[model samples]
Structures are given as structure tokens and as C-alpha cells.
Target: MSETWFITDEQAAQQALEAWREATVVSAFQAHQALDDTGYIEAVETVIADPATTEKTRRAWNMAQEFRRMSPTVLELAAALELTAAQVDELFEYALTIEA
Candidate 1:
């Protein structure tokens, strides 16, 4: 038997949102680097036209498109977590810093 650790629903939601934000930042950064190295539009067109593209590559390309359109925002997290306006504002401020 192993010990089980439990957290409040709010705590769990906050943790999940934080993890998602971190992942978004890292993914966006890597995607930006790749696009910058290869030429953004050209790289995306190449990736989409290539039949041999791996799932991971496709995912990165999709993320690049989304990031280019609008970097992921804390409003998304807030909606997913059902957070209050004040909490969302706080998270939004922190999220803005993640990419920088």
C-alpha cells in the first residue's frame, strides 16, 4: 500500500492550470525558435505539406500557429478552473511573465 495525498478542489485546479501554463510557455518558446530558424510561414507550409511529418511535429506546428495568433492566456485557465475575476487577473499577470 502507498500513501495517498489529497488536496482541495481549488488547489488541484490551481496546480493543473499552473502546469498547463508552464507547458504552453515552453512549447511556445521552442516553436518560436524553430520558426525563427527556418522562416515562419515557409516552415509551416513545409510541415503541413510534408506527408512524413510526425505527430509531434504536427503538434508543434499547430502550437506555433496558435501562438502566433495569440499566445495562450490565463483567461483560458480561468475558464477551465472556474476562477474568480480577481484570481484570473493575478494569473494573467503571471502568465504574461512566463513567455518573457
Candidate 2:
């Protein structure tokens, strides 16, 4: 028989909030996959290819091992992606669940 574990709604909410708070960083692969799954991969690639994006930002995007939720580049990219604050948070939350 399979075992089951259950948590109260309040406890689940607290755990989810904690996970969101702790998910400040995720692997580059995870980030990319999350974007792809959400249908924003092409949009992000377009933004990266835009001439307005700085060379430094492009370098970080192309080479970083992990992405930080609040990094300047990420914030800029989120804006460029036309994602609202909640959307950015959701993306990060989803990315955190991804395994390498």
C-alpha cells in the first residue's frame, strides 16, 4: 500500500510561502525550461537578441550557472518579457520545483 501525508490548508500555505521565499535562485536549465513551458522562451530569446540589451546582460544571460530572482538582469528581462510582478514570482516559484 502507498503511504499518504496530508497537511492542513493553513500549513500548506505556510510551506508554499516559505518555498517561494527560499527560491531566490534556480539553475539556468531550470529557468529556461520553466520559460519554455510557459511559452515565453521565444519571447525571452527575442529580448536577448534585441540590440538594446547591454553586452554585460547578454553575457550573464548566456553564461550564468544560475538565475537570481532579484538580480538587475532578471528584473530587466522580466520587464522586457512583459511579465507583471506576480507573473515573475510565479515563474520563479515554478522554476524552483524543477530538478537538475
The total of clashing pairs for model 1 equals 0
What C-alpha lDDT values do all the predictions have?
0.48, 0.88
Predicted structure 1, TM vs. truth = 0.25
Report the backbone clash tally of model 2. Answer: 0
Cα distance off (Å), candidate 2, residue 46: 0.4
Write one digit per residue (lDDT tens) for candidate 1, span 1-100. Answer: 9999989999999987666545543345544454445344364456555676555545555554334222333233234345576554443344345553
TM-scores for all predictions: 0.25, 0.76
Least lDDT summed over 10 consecutive residues: which range in candidate 2? 14-23
Task: In model 2, state the lDDT of residue 12.
Answer: 95
Give the number of the best model, judged by lDDT. 2
Find the 10 residues in a row with the least total lDDT in model 1.
68-77
lDDT of 2 by residue, 1-100 (tens): 9999999999999887767645589899999999999999999899899999988889988999989887888889998977887798899889989887
